[model samples]
Target: MVQNGQVFKILVVDDEMSMRELLEILLLKHGYDVRCAESGSSGIEAIRSDPPDLVITDIRMEPVNGIEVLKKCKAVSPRTIVIMISAYASTELAVEAMNEGAYDYFPKPFNNEELLSVISNALRNRGEEQSVSDSREGLLYFGCLIGESAPMLKVYETIQRVAKTGSNVVITGESGTGKELVARAIHRQSARRDRPLVIVNCGGVPENLVESELFGYRKGAFTGAASDRKGLVEAARGGTLFLDEIGELTPVLQVKLLRLVQDKTIKMVGGTEEIPVDVRIISATNRDLERMVMEKTFREDLYYRLNVLHIRVPPLRDRREDIPVLARYFLSKFTKDLGKEIHKVSSYAMDILCNYEFPGNVRELEHIIERGVAMESSRIILPDSLTLSMHRRKEQERTVPAVRSEIPIENFDLDKHMAEIERRMLQQALSQAGGVKLKAARLLGISFRSFRYRLLKHELATEDELKEE
Candidate 1:
C-alpha cells in the first residue's frame, strides 16, 4: 500500500541494460524506490512476487515483449500503471498499447524530462483512479472540454440532444466554464458542420461600432466605410453565428438582434436592402439575462428569443471531479506544444489545484498549468510551481488591514492611492469573474476596452491572462 508522501516503488523491465540502468538511476534520484528486471519474464515473476506501483517496460523483448508484459502486469495487479517504451514507435503499436490499457507510450530516445513527467502523471492518475468510484471512471471529451461529473454528463446529454436541431441556443455559464467550446461542439455536431462558424464578441466591439460590425456596412456607411463590408450575420450565411458575451450588447443593438433572431434577415448599416441570412444563432454569456430583463437593462423580448434552447454550464467548483482529468489534459497539451519534457502535476500540486477556488474556471486552470509547465525545471509540477490567485488574495487580505491602520492623512498620495485601489478592485473583479476580462469589466461597470487599458496601465495582467474565458 502506498502512503502519502512515501516514495513510490517502480519496476523497470527492459532487455537493454543501458535503458534499464538509466531509468533505475533516474527514478532513484527522484526519490522513487526503483527495481530493475533484465527480461519480461523476470519482470512478470517480480510482479507476481510483489507488484510495484508502476511498471516501465521496453518493447521487442525476445520471448515476452512489452505488450505481453503489460497484459501480464494487468492480469496480476489491475491497479498497477504500465508504461510502454519502444524504439520503433508506430501508430499501430501506440494504439495497441492504449487499447491494452497502457498508461502511456514513450518512444525510444524520449527526453528524460518528458519520460519523468509521463511517469509522474501515470502515478498520479493511478492514485486518482483508485480513489474514484468505478461508475465515475469514464469521462467523455468533446473537442477541448473534458469532464465526467454528473453535471458534465448532463451537459453532454443536452449537447447530443440539441445539436441536430435548428433551435437557437443560449449557453450561460460563469466565465472560463467553456461556453464557446460548447458552441463549437454544437456547430460541429450539427448539420452545418461544413459551413463556417462566424464568431462575434459583443463586448469586444465598440458600442458605436457593434451595429455595423454585426450588420455589415455598404460603402459610405460611415467616415471610414470605404467599401461594402459583409456583416457577421451575412458571413455566417448557412452556418452558425456565435454571439459571445451577448449581454454586453447595447439596448439598441439588442432590438436589432431581436429582429434578426425573429426573422433570419439583416439590414446592412447603410444599405436599404434587407438581406436574408440563413444562420443558426448560438449565443453565450456569463450574465443573467433574466435578471437584466427584470431590471429593464436587457430587453425582455430579446431575452425570450435567445433563451429558446438554454445550456447552463456549471462552474469549475461545481464540477470538482473533473479537475484532475482537466489538469492532466492541459499538462499533456502544454508539454507537447512547448516541446518541453514536463509530464505531470505532483499529487500535492493537484490537490492544491483541485482545492483552490478557480474563479477563472477552466481558462484560469489552463493558464496556471501553462505557467507551471513553462517554469518547472523538473518533470513533476509540485505545489510550488502553482501561482494561485487565492494565495495573492490572502496576501491582499492580510496587508489591507495593516495598510488601513497605518495610513496617514498628511502624507497621502491621492494619485498613487487611487491607482492602487483601482488595481486591487480590478484584481478582485477578475478573481470574482474567473479571469474573464469581459465579465470583470461588466462587474466593474466598465467597458471591455477600458478594462483592457486599465490592465495595461497597472501592469496587473495581460490579454493572454483572460484567454478563452
Candidate 2:
C-alpha cells in the first residue's frame, strides 16, 4: 500500500517457490512493492541489505528457520513489522512467535482479505507512531488532552472552530473521557480567555439550593442571606460558565437554567428584576441528553439552546493507538512528581496496556500509569506493576502455574514458589475488583476476614485499603 506518495514494501519469505510467487502477486496487485525470498537465509540477507516496511514469512525452513529470520530482521531494524505464516501452526508456535516479537501470526489457508486488513492496520499503526514521535509534545497534546488519533483531531478542529464564537456548546461522552478538558480548551481559545471561567457541577449542588446557588440572592432573600451575593451565573459575567452533568438538573432548576440560556438573563432569589449576563454557556454530560429530552426528563428547549454546537469525546478504546504516547506522557509527569528516575514501560507491559479495553477511558489510564510509577522499584515499569482487570490476566495466571509445574524438581523451591503464587492470586483478585475487599474476597471464595488476613500475610493490601477497613 502507498502512504504519502511512498509505497510500502513487503518481503514474502517461503521455502516453496510457488508460495513465494503467490504472495508476491497478491501483494503487488494491492499496490505494494513486493519482494520474494526463497528461504529463511535469503530473507535474512535481504533484510540486512535493505529492511522492508513489513515481512511475511513461513515458520518452517531448512537450516535457518523463520524464527531465526525474525530475530535477525528485528535486530537489524526494530521498527520493521513481522507476520508469521505456517501450515503447521499450533498454539505453542503462535505463542512463541508472538513472545519473540512477531506482530501477528497466521495459520495456513488464511483468508486473503483478513491478511490484507492486518497488513493495512500494522502499517497504519507504524505511520501513526512515526507521526507522534516526530512532534510528541507539540502535535498530539491539546491543552490537557493527549492523543494523535483521528477522533481527537476532529475534536481539536471542532474546538478551534467553535471557540471563536459565543454560541453554546454541548460536549457528550462517557465518564472519564475528558469532556471537561474539552470545555477548558474552548474557554482557553475564546475571546474571554483572561476572564474567569466558572465551573458548576449541576448534579453536585443540592436540589433545594440549586436555584439560589445558580442565581444570586438579594439581601434577606433567605434565612442565611444576610447580604446580597452574586451567584455562579453573575460571577461569570463577560466569561464562560461550565455546567457539568447538566442532565442531573431537576425540572425546576432546568426552567431557571433555560431562562438564562434563552435571554442571557437570570433572576435573583426573592428579587423583582432580571439581570442580564453576558456569559457563554458550555454544558457537558455523560448521559444521552437526546434520549433524556425524548423521555421528558430534560427540557427539549434547553437541549437545543445548549446544543447549538456539539462535540463528542472519543473513549480510550476507540483511540488505542495513542496508549503508548499517553503512557509515556504520564510516566514523565509522575516520575517528576514522585522524584523517581523511572524512564520507560517494559515492552510486554505496554503490550498488555494497549490490548486492554479501558472502560474508564483516559482518566483510568492516567491512574494506571501513576500507580505503575509508584509501584515500580526498577527503572522501567513491568507487567506486575500494572493493575489491570482484564480477563486475559486471569488466563495468564492459569498458564503461569502450569509452566512452573514443568520446571525441573531440582531447580524448584516449593516454599518460594508457593508463596509467589499466593501473592500473585491475591493481587490479581484485588485488582480485578478495584481494591474492594468484600468483592475480592468473594472472587477468591473466602470471607472478608480471611481475605484481610491473607493480604496482610502477603503484604498486598494498600495502606488506604487497610485504613478503610
Candidate 3:
C-alpha cells in the first residue's frame, strides 16, 4: 500500500509526447510514484480517482489545456500543487496563469534546476489534509518547518541536533525568511522548553535603552527606571533569550553583549553585583555578520561566540519547493482569521507565487496571502491579489537563489523580450540626449535618476560613475 511520507505521488500532464515521457522518467528515477496524462481530460479523470501530491502541466496543450487541468485539480483537491509550463515567453500570460490557479509557470527552454525548483515549491505548498485534522497551540503542524529541497532538509536535520545543545546559536537569512520561527522551534525543542522564551529585537530598540534592556536597571538607574526593571536576559534566566537582528547592535552594545556571552554574567545599571544568568542565546539576522565585521560594523568576537550553532533559513526562492505548503499554511491562517470558508488557490495564481523571486521571502509571502484573503470574495485566493512590483529594480545579486530551476526548455532564449525592450529604450534615450544623462532625462520627461539609470543599465557609465557624471 502507498502511504504518505514513504513516497510522494506526482502527476505530469503534457500534450507533447517527449515532454511527458521525460518528466515521468525523471520523477520515477527520483523514487516518486508518478502518473501522467497526455491530455487534460485524462488528467482530470486520474486526479478524481487518486489525487497526486503534485501536478506539472504544459500551458499549450491539445483538446484540454493545462489551464483546464489546473482548474480540475483544484476542484477535486484544493491543495494539490500545480505547475504550468509554456514554450512562449510572456509575463502577461504568466500573470494570467497565476490569476487562473496554476502554482507557477515555467518558460520553455528552462533549466533543469528551474523546473525542479517549481516542482518542489508546488509540492511543499500542498498542505491540505484529506481527512479531519488536529492542531496544537494554533499550529497546523508543531515543530515542522516543511521543505523537501536538499538545503531545507539539511536545515531541518541541523535543527534536530542543535536543539539539544545549550550553546549559543546564530540563525541567518533574509528578511521575512522566518528567522524568529526557527528560533522558536529551537526553543521549543530545547531542554528549557518549560522555561520562558524571551525575545528582544536589537534593530527595533533605541540605542539609549538597549543597555538597560539587556541588563536590569535599578530604580534610580535612568529616567524611566522608577522601579527596578528586569532586562530580557534576566527574564529569560534558566530559559532562552532570542536576540533578533543581532548584527544591528552598535559597537558599544556589542561590547556588553560580548561580555555577557563571554563572562556568563551581566551587570545591572547602577548595581555593583555581577549577576550570572543561565540562558541559551539564539541570535538571528538577515545581515552578514562576517561581511559586517570586515566593514567594522559588527564585532567579530561576538559573531564567533553566537555562531557556535548556526541554522540558516533558506529564502523562499531558494526552496521554491516549499512555497506551496507555506502558501497553503498562510491561506488556512487567513481563511480562519477572515471567517471565510475558502478552499483552494487558482492553479494560475499558485504558478505566479511559486515562480516569482520573493525578495522579501516568506514574510512577504504571508503579507501577500493576508491581502489575498481580504480581496478574495470566494474561497480561492486569486493571483491578482499579489502586489509585487515586477518592474522594480532587480534584487541585489549578492546571493544566488539556494535552489536552481528545473525543466529547462531546449534552445529557448531567456529574458529576451525584456532585454529587447530595454535595448531599444536605451538607444532612443541616448539619441535624444546626444549621449548625455541630463539631456536624456529631459527628452524622456523622466527624472535625473531615470536618465542615470538608463545610462548605467546600458553600460554607458559605471554604476558608481553614473552619479559622478
Top-lDDT structure, candidate number = 2
Give one clash count per candidate, in the order shown.
Answer: 3, 0, 33
User: Against the true structure, whose TM-score is highest?
Assistant: 1
TM-score of each: 0.60, 0.59, 0.58
- The lDDT for every candidate, in the order shown, is 0.79, 0.82, 0.74
Off by over 4 Å in 1: 1-140, 388-469
Error of 2 at 103 (Å): 16
The runs of at least 3 residues in candidate 3 whose Cα sits more than 4 Å from the true structure, single-residue gaps closed, are 1-144, 388-469
Q: Which pairs of residues collide in model 2? A: none
What order do you get sorting by TM-score, best first?
1, 2, 3
Model 3 TM-score? 0.58
Task: Summarize candidate 1's per-residue lDDT along 235-328 as a digit string, tens digits.
Answer: 8889999999998898889878988988877888888987888889899999998899999999988888878899999999889989988888
Candidate 2 residue-wise lDDT, 1-469, digit = tens? 8866889989999998888888998899999999999889989999999999999999989988889989999999999999998888454665556667788777788778778977886888685675675465424445577887898888999999999988999999988889999999999999999998998887633454567668978888865567887788998999999999999999989999889999889999879899999899999999999999999999999999999999999888788888888888899999999999876675556767887777677887899999988987767676667874532531332112322766653324678688877777876786577556688799999998888888888755445436634
Sorting all predicted structures by lDDT, with the top scorer first, yields 2, 1, 3
Residue-level lDDT tens digits of model 3 in 2-98: 3345577888888889988888887777677888888889888999999987888887777887788888898899878777788876556665566
